[model samples]
Target: MHLSHPTPLQNIMESKTCSRRGILLPFNSYSSHKKDAQHCIFCDTTFPLRNFKGKAVCPTCSQNILKLFLEREVR
Candidate 1:
């Protein structure tokens, strides 16, 4: 007998919010946005994507914020 299961690629393809290259979607080929978020990461703060002077925020803080934001949406 043979059985079938959803492969990792299939699972991703089936997702509605599937993003690629950390961009909007479908265009981003790198798929760098496939990251997980943590709970209680952001206590009380609104994290902006890019800060003033067009410079990005601190890497550590940015990562934490991204995780928190994503986790919240997932729930």
Candidate 2:
């Protein structure tokens, strides 16, 4: 039997390295899961609960919650 030519995915998979997006997809998925599954990392009391663009405001405080989030997690 004859083999088919390699597809783009086959090329990526056969290579020793992953593309930038491929390398980061798991990180993005994890971030998305964390962003979706938990409350605002700032106040730690309000869940985003609705939006998937990955944004939400704390119900009790006006703050750049995403900034607070990354700061908290990096420690």
Question: Which candidate gets the maximum TM-score versus the true structure?
Answer: 2
Q: Candidate 2 on 1-75: residue-level lDDT in tens?
A: 655898788897877475454433334555666655656434556553434356544554344556666877999
Global local distance difference test of model 2: 0.56
- Please give the clash total of every predicted structure, in order: 1, 0
Model 1, span 13-71: residue lDDT tens: 77856554464544644345434322222442334333523544544556676676688
Q: Which residue pairs clash within candidate 2? A: none
In model 2, state the lDDT of residue 45.
Answer: 60
Taken over the whole model, the C-alpha lDDT of each candidate is 0.52, 0.56
TM-score of predicted model 2? 0.22
Question: Which structure among the candidates has the greatest lDDT?
Answer: 2
